[model samples]
Every structure is written in C-alpha cells, then in structure tokens.
Target: MFCQLNKTKKRWRSMFTVVLTCPKEQEKCKLPPEVCWHIGASISNGSWLSQFLSVFLTDLKIDQIVTFLPLPPRALPLQELVDELYNFRDCYFETHGVEEAGRKQSDVAKEIEKTLKKLEEKEDHFKHKAEFLLQKGRCLNVAPDFSAVAEECLSRAVKLEPGLVDGWNTLGEQYWKKGDLIGAKNCFTGALQQSKNKVSLRNLSMVLRQLPAADSAAHAKQVMESVDMARQAVQLDVTDGTSWYILGNANVSLFFSCGQNPQLSQQALSAYAQSEKVDRAASCYPELHFNRSTLFQYEEMFSSALGGYSRAAELDPGWEEPLEREKQLLEYLRKVTELLQNKGKVKARRLRTMLSNLSTSALGPCSSPEFRSPTGRVGSLEPRTLSSLTQGHNAGVAALGKVVFSLASEGRMAFTFGMVDSEETCIVVMVYNTADSWGVLIGDSVVIPEPQVKRNSITHKDESFDFRSIRVDSPLLLIVNGKKQNVQSQLAASVSYKPLSE
Candidate 1:
C-alpha cells in the first residue's frame, strides 16, 4: 500500500487529508474505524497530531508520508540575532541621509530595545545583552535630544562589560556632545587604556586639541600631542577616512594655535584630500567641509571657501554655523568690493601726502632692522612696497601702507581693513588676535615687517574681486603710527572646538 498526504491552511486553521491506496485493487483503502483520527484546531496547536502522524506512518512503513510532516522551528542563537540587528542598524544608517538618519535611528533603537527585553529573560545571554545596549546607545547618541537615554544605556553597557572599548568611545562621544570635555577626555583615555584602537586615538587627539592649556607654550604642547596622536591613529588604519580627517583637524589646530605655519596648512589640506579619496562618505561630513572652508578662507581662496561652506550647509540643513559663515564671508567680500570701487575717490594729493608721511621712526624700540637673509646671514633689511612682496611668506621683507578703509571685524578674532601702499598698490590687511582698543582707523600709517601675503581673485555670484592681502597673526607684529602695539592690545586666543562630524 502507498500513502499520500495533502495539507491546506486558511486563516489560523489547517487541514490535512491522507489517502491509502492498495496496488492489487488499484483503489483507495479506508482505515479501520478504530484506527481513524481527526485533528482540529490552529496549525500552531496541532503539534500532537503532527507527532502522532510521524510515528504512526513510520510504524506502518509509510516513510513517504512521514516526510511530509512539519517540524518545530528552531530558535536562533542570541549572538547571531544581535549581529543581524547590528548589521541592519548599520545598513539603515548608511542608506539614509543625515537629516533622515535620526528618525530611522529611532526605529532601529526600538528594535534593539525589543531585542534587549527578550535577552533579559535569558540569563545566559548576558554578553549579548551588553552588546545590544551598546548598539542601542550608539544609535540614540546620534540625536542630541536623546543624549540622556543614550548616556544611561552606554553607562549600563560599560558597567556590564568594563572592557568594552566601543562602549567607552560611545560614552565619550556622549560626553563630548554634552560639552563635558573633562568627562569625554576621561572616557576616551579609558578606552585607550583598554586598547590602542584608531577610534579612541583619533577621538583623544580631537579632545587634546580642545583641552584648556595654561599658556601659549602649554597650548602648543597639547596641539603637538594632538597631532602625534592623530598620526598614530592614521598609522593604525591608513584607510580609515575618519582618522585622516581627525589628523587634518589636528594639523589645522597646530597651524592656527601655534605660529601660522604654511606647511602645517598644506599638511592639513593633504590629509583632507587623502580622506576624501579613501572614503566616499567623507563628502557627507559637514565638519570636514566646514573646516576646509575655514582653511580656504585663511588661504585667501574665497570662491573655494564659499563653495565649501555651501556644501557643508547642504550636508547638514539644520546647522546654522555654515550659513552664518557664508553670510559673513559674503558681507566681507561686499564691503571689500565697495571699498575697492571707491578707491578712485581718494585724491592723489592726499594719497601722496599719506605715503610721504609714513615713517617707522615712531616704531622706536619695536623696529627690527636686522633680518635673516636667504643665506641665513643677518643683514640690514629694507622695507619693500606691498606690490613687490612675493606670494606666501615674505620672511625677510617689510612693507609700509596707510589704512584707507576699515572693514567690520570678522568674528571676534580679526580686524580687517583696506590699505594703500607707497606704490599706489591697494591691498587688504587682516590683523588677528587684536583687542578693540587697538583701533585700526583709515589713513593710519601701518608698518608690517615679515608680512605674509596672499594674492587672491574671487568671482562669486554677482561680485568679482582681484586683490592681494597681508595676514598679520598678532597685533604685536604691527607698528601703527610709529608706535608698536604692546601685548596689552592683543586678544588672548579663544578655544572653539569643532565636532568630529555632523
């Protein structure tokens, strides 16, 4: 005899029909009334019937019938489930844009929380529970408003698994987001103690750069340390764009905080280029674009600076900083353009009189006549016209110009003004780290020694500009009206650290 089984499901109910055929008769055979069984209820509740059929068919030597029976589903391992959830979270984050990522993260966080709740019932899944908590915490950390819960979850995770480096790093990030620099620093340091990983190293490098230092020397030391740590992180993972980006930021800090080293700026740009090349996602990072824009602005690349700011704003629509920066840059350019347009209004007699009256005699003790020549020999250095100064750093050259128009201060750090040199060449002068007390008025004789010059031309939107400018890092470097600016007129450098990304 041969047996055949047919099954069907509707709603929650399942029906199974079995037929037995006799080869000799070539017809279906009915089981004895005592042997017949009828099972009813939902498929989930029909386990007993399934088990009975398996044994009953095997006993009758009907193996083909037994093969059709359904087996109970096996439970997935907790570790595997956790891994899948993490993968799902990461894939969702990557696929969504930054603006939409927050909402998506909330959905992912709910799934992770559900998993965590299930894990709580299984005492053996302690490790998996900690991992879930870490994942959940990281997800929530992306949105600043969720920081409180994120911190709680991260804290619990670290408490459960003290050696979890990622937990520590996420906690550090949480602290950093909340502006608790000391707490963030400690968390990153703790993560480093566990292992010298790229994430912790790069984060530590960023924190180090922002840490408060007692003096300029101490600040320089911290900045150099930041650079060293960032370099180590890059060495640890050459392909990690985040590390390269952090290294770029550290170099930028070194350039601005320490002496304005052009080489350091170049190094920063190179690092950023490497980051962009290695990581396709670097373009989505607003911080990278914003920082690069700041550097471009410093380098006198106005068009590139504007584009960078615009890109950064596009990447992070809610962030107003890039927009504010773009506005300030446009305003500065407009003011400069207006000043340039009215350059012809100043009479030749007044210009000549101002140029002739420009004297360094008032510089007195602040004047440095001896400059190191190209051969490294100290010699009498003669002042050159602004037009004669070469691009980049004019190391041994000096220039004298009269301030013709004072522009509005950009941020609280720099005072910008238009200047006309002795040769009738007009230029822009930016004196950084100056106090409001050091008034930079129009027609004031300004003597700059060892001026750093950048010849820039910007054609942005409806405005076009072509000019050469001098950047003086400190007011002490300027001799105004024959009197050298004292340290009292210099503003102490303020610390405003940028986030790793937006």
Candidate 2:
C-alpha cells in the first residue's frame, strides 16, 4: 500500500501560495482543479533555498495557512531549521549585497581591522597573535602603528615559541613592509621549513614575486614546489583560506611568467573566489580585485576592468598599477566611442561632448603636473596642438579599423601589436620582448584574425567601411613558446605593403 498523492498535496498546502486560487479571486481563474492550484514560485537554484525555507517557514505563525494541509505535514517540527535559516539569511544578505555593490576593495582594510580586534581579544593565543601580527604588518601602509605593534608581537611570539611557523611568517611580513626583500624572503623560507601550512607557502611565493630577474629562476623553482605543497594542503583541508589564496597567487605568477593564457587567468580567478569564500575576512582582497581586473581587461570588458581597478585602488590607494589601468580604460573607452559614432547620432554627440570635457578636465590647471606639457619649451610647441594631432591620428587609426592587440605568447612578456604607417609604406611592428622593441615587418599578406569587425570611415562623418586593421582587436590564441628573443630572425617573412583602398 503506497502512500497517496494526496499526502504530497497536503504537505505542500501551507508552503505554496495561492493568490488567485483564493475565494476572493475565484472569478479570475477558469481552469479545472482551481481549488488547490497555486501560482507556485520559489527561488531558483532551490537547493539552498529549499532548506532555508524549510527552516524559516517552521517558525512563521501562518496557523490558518498550515491548517489547510493534513497531518502528514507535521514533520515540520524541527528546531535546527529555524537556527540555520537565521544564520543563512544573515550571511546570504551580507555576501550578496557586498558582491552586488562590487565593493570588494574595502574588504582588506575591513578584514584587517576585524582581525586586529580579534587578535587583541585573544592576546594569549600564540596562533591568533601571530596571524594578527602578520596580517597587520601586511596592511601596514594603511596604519603604520599596527606594523610596529605587529613586529613587537611576532618578536615576542617567536621568543616564546621558537618553532611557531606563523611567528616566522609574521616576521617575514614585517620585513616585507619595510622593503627588505631579501630579509622577507629568508623569513618566509624559514616559516615554510618550520610548517607546511598553505599560508606560509603563499607568503613564500609572495616574497619570491619581489625577486629580481637574476634571482627569478630560483624563485620560480621555489614557487613550483610551493604549488605542489599547496595542492596537498588544499587536499588535507579544503576549507583552508590561506591555501586557496596561495594557490590563486601562485597561478597568477605562473600566468605572468608563461604568458597571458585566458584559461589560466580564469583559473586564477576561480581560486581567488574560493579563497574569498573560505574566509570572507581575508586581507588579500586587493590582489584578488587586481587579478580579476586584469582578467576583465583580457576579455576586453573595459568597463568591468575599470570597475575592478577602481575597487582595487580603493583597497590600496597607493598602488599605482590599478590607477594606471583605470586611466587607460577611461581613455580607451573614450577613443572607442569616438571611432564608433555616426553623424547626427544624439547619444554619440552627447558622448563626444562628455569626452571633450573629460580631456579638458584631465589637463587640469596650468601649474599642475597633469596639465603641464611634457615638452619643456614654452614657445617651441603648443602642448594642446601636439595632443590634438596625436589624438586625431589615434582616432583616425581606430576609425580605419586598426585595433590594438596586447599579445603575450608563452614565455613572452606582453607586447603591443600595431602598424607603423607613413606616407610611402605601411609596416607591421611586432614589438617583441619589450615595449620598445619595435621591429618593422613590411607586409600586406599578414594573417589577421578571422572575421574582422567593420569600422567607421575617417573621411566621411556618416560613412563606414568594411575593412580590417591591426590596431582594434584583442589577441586570440595562447600559443606556447611563441616568444622569440629576437625579431631579426623573422625579418625575411615580411613583404612590403601599399595603403589599402579607403
């Protein structure tokens, strides 16, 4: 004798809403079986929500609503559901709002503050003391007083417990804050030796990131070993916050060394996300935001990149990288908009006016450095004249369908792929190895990425052309070992080119 379907129906009676099925709204519904019908809507991704609802609804005093159901539904008498729901709701709201606000930059300072308070509260606990000290030292630029206190605390902890792995890590962090790279590196090494903790491994990797090129090979070796050790740490404790942070950072370094593989960038993002979740209050938010910004930039989501960098800047205002990136994003966005505008388009016209104002604002007052001409001579060249000419040239290039692609083939540093066009000849400049390595590759038969996007014409305001150019698109592939030390060897591969029909 199987239980009847009526039991399942009764179980759902109180849980479901029947707004239209109520007696007051009966005339609005013409369908059969209307008495029990419900405009049943529960939240999507119902796995977490169902359990949450199960708990929350138990405490809800909808007695009349519950009375509509039969006795089989009486299994809703669990107290655990109520407690879990309260906690889950609190956490869900906080995290969701934080993510939606995209205010992850302030997370570092906030977390550091919380950690400091916790450390002070548990001053006698050696592990907590060391962690607090280390985190405080890392965040010293914001509050230098914390750094002094952190160092003193770690020094005392080390004296009390010579083999404490975290004490050594805290010591390393203090050295790092003071710009003593070598000392920091040695301290991290000592910490790693004392303890095989993921946090220590990550600290070691961070110290290695500061090493010079001559020392980078050794750093890379250590990083790989640390990664292997971190993998084990992750396996041992999946919820370890420090382990995931280390893994994310390790992958970032690997990507920077191996060249810009989007997949690797994404992997790094996922690891960072996991780390952020393992401990929402971790002090690595700035790094996470910066890395994620770089990923957005790679994906050509310039607006998102700008937002991420802006957040990173908020987290660590003195960090120049994100600031520079934010400036670049604004400039690129403006340039892209101008190149795409059609004549008499109201929005485009508005954007142009906005961009004009931005350019003017960027120049600032005459005495300010932002406005001061790069050229020292006052009468020799009008700065705005030069700027206007450069802007015009760039705008023309963009309008002519040339997309600037930042390329990073494996084992290669990032480089600009653009064309050098003068009156007589046009040549592709494969600036290999470094930013200044501009090798003129004279060619018309170059293999451009397929199915190029059409761009507007520079001559006629309303006219657009279906054409391909090098200055407008992002890179496509991540070919390993594509980085050659010298471009001279590939000189024979280029052929001379004449300007195409406009």
Candidate 3:
C-alpha cells in the first residue's frame, strides 16, 4: 500500500514534508510509529544535531527557538543525551556479540562515519536503507554543527515510502532542531496523515506554540487553530502525559504569542495539573514538571513554583531552563524587596501585587520605551539638561537612554540598563537614533544556546526581520518589520551605538 504512495510522491512534489518508507522488520513492528528525533532542532532546519552532538553541548530548548536561527557562540552542556547514544553504540556491539571496548566518547565521528561508509553500498530494501541512514545520522549528529548527508539519507528513505511515519517524523525533528518551526510543522503534519501518532501531534503543537504573533485577523485565526490542533492531539490520545504536557505549553504560547484570551490561564494550569495527575509513566516526562513550575512562577505561587522548577532541574540535571528561570525569579524577588524599601508599605504592596498578577507579562509587543519622561515622571532631554536619573533610586535598575540602528538586512536596537540605586546610572549618558518607522519592543526574553553567557550582545529574529543588539535582560529591541525603502547597512554607523549594560 505504501509502495504505491511512494511512486505518487515522485510525480507531485508540492509540500516540503517527507514521505516515510515501510519498516524493514514490518511483520510485527517493534520500532516507534513516528521516528522524529530532535537532538537539537531550531527554526532554520530541524537537523540541529550538530548543536547537541559533536562536543556534547546542549543549552538550546524549545522556548528560545524562533523562525530565524543563529548558531550559539558557546557550548551548551549535553552530557545526558550524549551518554544515551553511547549506550546505543555499545548495545549495538553487544547485541552483535562483538567484544572490542566501546568507542571513545570524544570521538563521535569514527563510528558515525563508519556507518556512513556502509551506507555508500547499495541496498535492495529501501526500508533497511532508510533505517541505516537514520542510525548513521543519529550517531553523526551530536553537534557543534549540522550534516546535509544525514538529512539526505532520511529524505531518501521517506521518498521510498510515505507511510514510514518514523522517517517523516525524524526528518521533521531535524528541522525543529534548527528552529525551522514551519518545516517541523509540515513534517509532523505529514506523519499524522499517515497515522495518528501522538508524538508527532505533540511536536507539531510545540512548533506552532513558539511562532511569532500574527497581527492580521487571518493569521491570528491560524494561531488559534494551531492551538486547537494541539488540544485535539491530547483528546485523540489520552494515555500518555506528553500530549497533555504539550497541550498545556501550547496554551501558554497562546497567552504569550497570541493576544489575551481570558480562559487561557486556567486552561494552561489545568493541562499542567492533568499531566502531573496522569498515569505514573506520563508523570515521568521532564517537560511536565518544568512547564508546571514555569506556570506556577507566572501565577506568583513562588514557593510552589520554586519546588517544581527544582524538580525539573533534578530530572534533567543538564537542562538550563529551570536554573535560568530561578535566576530571573530571584532578580524579580530582589526588586520587590527594593520596592518595599523605596516606596514604603502602601506603594510597595501595589507593585508586589502587580508582579504577582503580571497584568502585562514578559510577552508584550514592540512599543516605544516608557521613558520615565513619557509619563511626566521625568522630563525629556533638551540640549543642555542633565537630570539626576538614578541619584536617589536604590531599589532597581533604571532604563537609561536607548539607541536605534539600521542595517540592510537587519536592524539593531539597545537600551542601556544600570543599577537604579548605583552611581553608574548617574555617570553614563544614553543616546537614541530615530529611524523612519521603528519602535522599541519591551518584555521579550532572548537566550542564545551556543555561548550560554553572552556578556556582550544578543540576537533574535522573526519571520520577517533580523535583530542584533546588547545583552541586557530586557533591553529595548530595534525593529524593522515593515519599512518599504532599501535599508542601508551603514545606517547604524551614522547613529551612535553602545552595548547593553548589566
């Protein structure tokens, strides 16, 4: 049945998704129905194994992924997944009854290359050929890089048979690894068409959840539909907790990426709680605990959220989300204390309540920086005025001056951040460069995986534009979303630029 489908795929190639081949041992298949494996896929191209496999660094996660992809400058710690692949290698030798000591952990290329060499020889069975390709790709892809050869192998396997759900899913996983959410979505959709696989559904939902918001009514409708599809996946298969967990996460996306939907909060919490209360095996998923903790943090259930985040960190000791969130929360907590000291009991309490409720959380759209001057709290700059911006403020960091720069293919935006109570705020002068039509975007977080600690600058992008600027936690972002004129690369040089402050 699937063989005919393969022939059909060759005739009409409209979609980007791969068609999977039949399994080599199909009499009674033991392998997973969907073979989507994402060692580390971001939005660019899901074959992101190089980021996680080569030197065993793995700081990237689904949250940081965007339609535009950038290589991490530093190595992320990925020892756990690396160890599993090593075990797979050893088990392969053991099952074949070979007695040579296992391959050195550091030399990942030798074994994967050996398999790649074997794949060079023609095989009669397309199913087996695809399996061999997946295996080699698996071994070869522990990253600091990406592999086109592996992508081709998997692509060929799926072309040989569209029903090979595993092949399609794996191919999609490669795209997800590279942060190519659109590509990942297509692959998972293809897998779902062949068979109702929960993993593919969950994965598709995840990719959809991370997409940037669409302003047009049509695009907004699509986002809601994507969230609903994720819910459907959970409804279709109630046995596992993964889909439930994904469903919770998808709702969180709706809250963040999409505009407000009053019930989203309760729905997200319900889904997370459901993941925890599900069968013991379902409760075992790490994402469940981590996501639950994140939602709790959002809800201002600080103590409970801390415990959940701690558990998530424990579950995946190498993972950084829980740890990073912990830091952000601590910073937020410290600020709360400062508010109490500076504003006295009444004012501090209101700010505390605001933090707890988070009426406008971290996912707001790009708008002009609420320069203290905008609200009449402080006055705008004139030719010779130098007001005491941070002289008396000891509780928090002050938003100093902002700058905007434009590049031909990209734009740069930065906000100078400094201690609200420290002398640095009073000493440094902030500068701003006006663009034709760009605004400052506040409340977004960007975490680069390569160099976990990027002290100098940060970069992020969406479907339309690219952004690069300083490393402050929530620095003002430069935007170039809809300018019709040709952008000049030297626009930034003409305008003054500076790094984001700590």
The candidate that achieves the highest lDDT relative to the unseen native structure: 1
What digit string (tens of lDDT, one per residue) describes model 2 on residues 20-39? 23455445544443233211
State how far residue 492 of model 3 sits from its true place (Å).
Answer: 30
Model 2 clashing residue pairs (backbone): 402-471, 402-472, 403-471, 403-472, 403-473, 404-471, 404-472, 442-495
- Cα RMSDs, all models: 9.9, 20.0, 22.6
Local lDDT at 118 for model 3: 48
The list of candidate 2 runs beyond 4 A from truth reads 1-146, 215-223, 229-233, 261-263, 276-284, 314-323, 336-435, 439-502
Q: Could you give candidate 1's per-residue lDDT for residues 1-502 as a string of tens digits?
A: 4344433335325444553433443334464322322231222345766665565567667444222122344344555556566556544536776567436646676877776666555645553567767766765564444378779978999999999999999999999888888999999999999999998888889888877889889988998999999999999989988889889988988888876678999999999999988877776677889988888877667899988998887666667888889888988887776776665357778888877877656334334445444335465446787768899877665677788887764653467877887678888788877777776877788877777888777876677778777888788877788776788888754435555452
Against the reference, the lDDT scores of all candidates come to: 0.73, 0.44, 0.43
Better of 1 and 3 by TM-score: 1
Per-model tally of clashing residue pairs: 2, 8, 45
Residue runs of model 3 more than 4 Å from their true location after superposition: 1-128, 134-147, 212-219, 257-262, 279-286, 341-502
RMSD from true fold, candidate 2? 20.0
Give per-model TM-scores. 0.70, 0.46, 0.43
Instruction: List, residue by residue over 245-299, the lDDT tens digit for candidate 3.
Output: 6677777656644433438868988877776577443454445666666555444
Q: Tell me which residue pairs clash in candidate 1.
A: 362-482, 363-482
Model 2 — which ten-residue stretch has the worst lDDT? 493-502
